[model samples]
Target chain A: MERGGVTVRVLGIDPGLTRCGIGVVEGIVGRPLTLVDVNVLRTSASVPIAQRLVTIERGIDAWLDEYSPDAVAVERVFARSDSSTIMGTAQASGIALVAAARRGLPVATYTPSEVKAAVSGSGRADKAQVGAMVTRILRLDAPPKPADAADALALAVTHVWRGGARARIDAAVAAGRTP
Target chain B: MERGGVTVRVLGIDPGLTRCGIGVVEGIVGRPLTLVDVNVLRTSASVPIAQRLVTIERGIDAWLDEYSPDAVAVERVFARSDSSTIMGTAQASGIALVAAARRGLPVATYTPSEVKAAVSGSGRADKAQVGAMVTRILRLDAPPKPADAADALALAVTHVWRGGARARIDAAVAAGRTP
Candidate 1:
């Protein structure tokens, strides 16, 4: 029986303008993932837009520097829904991706449903269900707060359980194509 | 009257994932503008997402280093329409904002209508009209190519004219609040 591969640390971002949720988890697939940290970075709407983005960027930079995650996962921005928040969400997603890329870490994005499915085994799972499952999976005292934080942790867990495998396959294919 | 205010150089970005348009112009509000440079940074959708962002980042960095614009103007992302490209647009916009923020330059965003109104005197002016007006304002031999470049120039021009006044007002308010 394989004891799985090396444990991978992941930082997940639930991107938003008002509150960007960030979470870090470490574990190998099929193993109990340890919750390293989870929190939301908040910025006021009154500030200039560029300054708001700077706040998010600073948060992301701090997390990346602290956790030193092996990979990053962010919620895929869906342009069809939530017209009001879509732009801010997408902007946050870009900041997350760039932070990971600058560190040479692999970056992946999953739709909201995929994160729900990975954590709760239902693509249509509600936020409460996903939060409950995340609590159960990490064996935490309580579910992460603010919903966005829970979503971030769920994304981290999801990427470890799913994106990790896909990343491995991608690497192998890239290596194969190399001369 | 006092020959307008100080000359302001603006780097305007028409953010797009496939082709980000960048332009630089220098002028004082209510004065004739001088065209500096206009070009598009191309990135293929086939490349990895992070890599694409890096390309845009690099282009912005180079432009900032070369031109040292007094401020940056990016077209505001509107999420209500164009679901197909909204995410990419927002992401590109984020990169632009971050680039300017890092350089300690003022970053401003203008809605599409505001840009049209400032450049062509009609809020609902079409792209061709904006482009023609941009050419006339800059006294160019021809309008910048690929429309996106022209739009970028128009944004720069708009920011110097309309946004400059707004920015001054904002600064005054900020100063007034500081006690």
Candidate 2:
């Protein structure tokens, strides 16, 4: 799937205390995206919260150093009825934002539905559908193992397709021109 | 308030996105506590969440470098009906944990009730009562401005009283001895 030029690389993160999924994708809008890497960072439940956060920070830093993506996208955490789970997720997401911002990388956040809609054209798409779309788009023989990993790849694809177009429009507007 | 010979310095943090309160206190339990410092770090709501977190990290790092506290105490964030406020608070608290853990400082978390009980001898103490107790305990001319600052001071006092005792107990147990 090829279109215009201006290739952009994006690192997307699905933050969690137990398993933080990270994926990198490279491509321009409307083009077949290449999966640079995909992995999940895990921290044990027995570990102290402070140490768990440090582990996530180190993992994100390593990915940033290795991939050096143009932008970072993190799943926006929402408060749920389960306060404990939401707290950990929100905290983990915060570390992702801090890591990307520390390196002066543009950071964007997308809701789960946003990523689902961008990939499958349906905000209400289920996980299996989203994963199927991601596998098809990346031309992978199989979907990424673990739901978090596939979710992260979906986030990167969403950003590359939506964020890329938004960035272009913003640049054109700043330059006093019409896109 | 001088029952013990050991004097431990503690830096307590009340984390929030709009205003994070930081305070340092030095003294042994049952003795008059000295307020080393107390201040609030403020970030504008207009700022992006990622940049706001960076601002907090820098502020905490500066405090850690300046005080060299033996330990850190952070107020535990609780989930409330106000999901948005809690999300920011949880994120900010994560930064505090990371900054202290990175420095290898022992970190403890205390709930609001614990802080209030430690200072006012009542877990259900109101804000004004807690502030008055903090002012009187520290022998300050006035209560710390803004509730966050006073809350931070209370957290430090709580750690100095409870955490110090717990550490001694753990050490004694590790040594197979009695305190």
Choose the strongest candidate by DockQ: 1
Among these predicted structures, which one has the highest TM-score? 1
TM-score of chain A of each: 0.94, 0.91
By summed lDDT, the worst window of 10 consecutive residues in model 1 chain B runs over B170-179
Please give the interface root mean square deviation for model 1, in Å. Answer: 0.9
Q: Which CAPRI level is candidate 2? A: medium
Q: List the residue pairs that clash in candidate 2.
A: B1-B30, B1-B31, B2-B31
Q: Write the per-residue lDDT of candidate 2 for residues B1-179, one digit (tens) a residue.
A: 84557889999999999999999999987779999999999999867789999999899899999999999999988776367788888998999999999888888899998999888999999999999999999999999989999999999999998997776775576577988
Per-residue lDDT of candidate 1, residues B1-179 (tens digit): 66558888999999999999999999986678999999999999877788798889889999999999999999998987587877888998999999998778988899999999999999999989999999999999998998999999999999988777777787877687532
Candidate 2 stretches with Cα past 4 Å from truth are A1-3, A167-179, B1-3, B168-179
Taking all chains together, each candidate's TM-score versus the true structure is 0.95, 0.92
How would the docking of model 1 be graded? Answer: medium
For A1-179, candidate 1 gives per-residue lDDT tens digits of 66668888999999998999999999998879999999999999888777888889999999999989999999998887677777888998888888788778999989999999899999999989999999999999988999999999999999989986788777776677532
